[model samples]
Target: MSTYDFAVIGAGISGASVAFELQAEARVVLIEAESQPGYHSTGRSAALYTPNFGPPIVRRVNAVGRAFFEAPPDGFAEAPLLSPRGALTLFKSGNEGELAAFLTNGTERDPIHPIPVAEALRLAPLIRPEMVAAAAFEPGVTDMDVAAIHQGFLRGFRRRGGDIRRAQPVTALRRDGATWRVTAGGEEISVATVVNAAGAWGDAVARLAGARPVGLVPKRRTALVIDGPADLDLHGMPLVEFAGDAPYLKPDGGRVMASLADETPVEPQDIQPDDLDVATLVEWLETHTKTSVRKAPRTWAGLRSFVADANPVVGFDPELTGFFWLIGQGGYGIMMAPTLARIAAALATGGNVPADAAAAGVNAADLSPTRFRF
Candidate 1:
């Protein structure tokens, strides 16, 4: 039987990043159910990196990961990982209080300033002039190349002698004394530890290993692409989001990528966009802006799994020996990948959290699986 120091399940961004981080120090094996890596959430992400997004814990991770995106390591990628693209959060009349609250909370750690309606319109002319009463601009937001980031990790892992097994869905897990026996694709492998980075199937994976479930719930979000005028020129526009939990629209290759921002609970599987959700997105777009959606648009959906507190769960399982969890990233997985990967690798290897993570105010205890032990 083949043996490794660690076995990481799932080959999405989360799994790939953690495997890459651990490969240099440990003999690691990455196991994926799909035929290719990043066939799910990672591939269908919005691919945006906003430092001020998500909850407090997520924000801290995002902040820690920013340095890596700004200046990647030598030969990490042929092209830049991030491209400049600002973000604007708009509010309509009678929603000033909500907008103020958003601005206050958003600017606490980042420099998201309030912009006048004219400036917001100048940044994104698609907004209906009469509908927008207030706007907050985050100038540091950028478009992330999701594929490049995932590939970079895979490359580094492969270069460090890490093994990756695709089309091998983990069917069973058995704890045998000091090692774990993992069954996938009718083959078995032994490892000293198992890291569950299965995203939406995190809880299911734990159950298969006879470990307690962490109450992970997957939620589906739909997005669509619409046609834009050839002469419109929206390459320099900021990502536009309506206030009070409304839909958002972003520039996508001269077209518009719109979403109703719907979060419907779902089972873990390959997801498809609902017709009603797409219609809702189009209706919201047409009602809020001068843009017209007269034809059917390209649409898709992805799953974002979350726990009760909406923060990530990382570290060793409280009750199961040699089982580490690196799940519950929610919608901020891409932005938080670097820091979370570092944290997971350190914790799984019995090492302390990175200094940069501590410097960014990341409380290792807060993200540990122990928090959900009770």
Candidate 2:
């Protein structure tokens, strides 16, 4: 039997990163159900780095994460993981409250500021002149090279002597005498601790381990790439979004990537894009912008898993021995990966939040799995 200090399930960005952080200090193994790591949300992410995007704690994590992305560990990645891309949010007549709500949560450190509709039109030329009333522009928003980030963590983990078990679906988890026997694929692994970074299948993994489900609801988000206006230069265009629950558009080369911004709750499974969602997005684009979906576009859907409070469920379970929760990252996982990974590693290895992360506004107690129990 191969024995280790910890077994991290799900080799997405979360698992790969935490494993990278923990392996140097203790023996660690990363077990992935899929043949390829980051096959789900991590792979499907639009990979935008918007500091003002997530909830409060997540925004804080984003602040802390910026340093790591700015200057990653030596040899972590060859090229930069972030590229400059601005985001512009348009508020039609009734959605001014939504814009206000966004500003209230943002800190002064963020580069987001209100702009006039004319400026929004100047920044993003496609918006219909009569459709927008006000705007908010955040110049700090960037495009993340998610694949590079995911692969870098994985490579670092393996280089640091962490074992990897791919194509291994965890079927059973049994604990005996301070050791967990994780049966996945055809073999069993003995480890002192288990970290559930299973993304959308998080609650299902918890149930298999005899731990209480943490109410992880997987929400589907559909995105499509469509040909847009041909005359304008879309390359330098900012991400244009409506203030409320409307579709958003981002320039993709000469094309545009559009999403209905739908958050439909569903059971965890291999998700597919709904036709209605794609159709709705097309309608929204035509109504809100000067662009039209001229042909059948490439489309896909991915699940963003979240708990009731919509923050990540990190830290160890209060009721389960040696079982830690690193799930429920939702749509902010990519942006929060660095800070969250460090936090998870620190907590798993007999420490609290790192000083930098703490200063950046991460409260350990708030992310504890104990919250879900009560």
Residue pairs that clash (backbone atoms under 3 angstroms), model 1: none
TM-scores for every predicted model: 0.97, 0.96
- lDDT per residue for candidate 2 within 274-311, as digits (tens), equals 99988888888889888877789999999999999899
> How many clashes show up per model?
0, 0
How many angstroms is residue 87 displaced in model 1 relative to the true structure, after the best TM-score fit?
Answer: 0.9
lDDT of 1 by residue, 102-153 (tens): 8765655567888888999988987788888888898888999999999999
Query: Each candidate's lDDT (Cα)?
Result: 0.89, 0.89
What are the root-mean-square deviations of the candidates from the true structure over C-alphas? 1.3, 1.6
Scored against the true structure, residue 114 in model 2 reaches a CA lDDT of: 87
lDDT of model number 1: 0.89
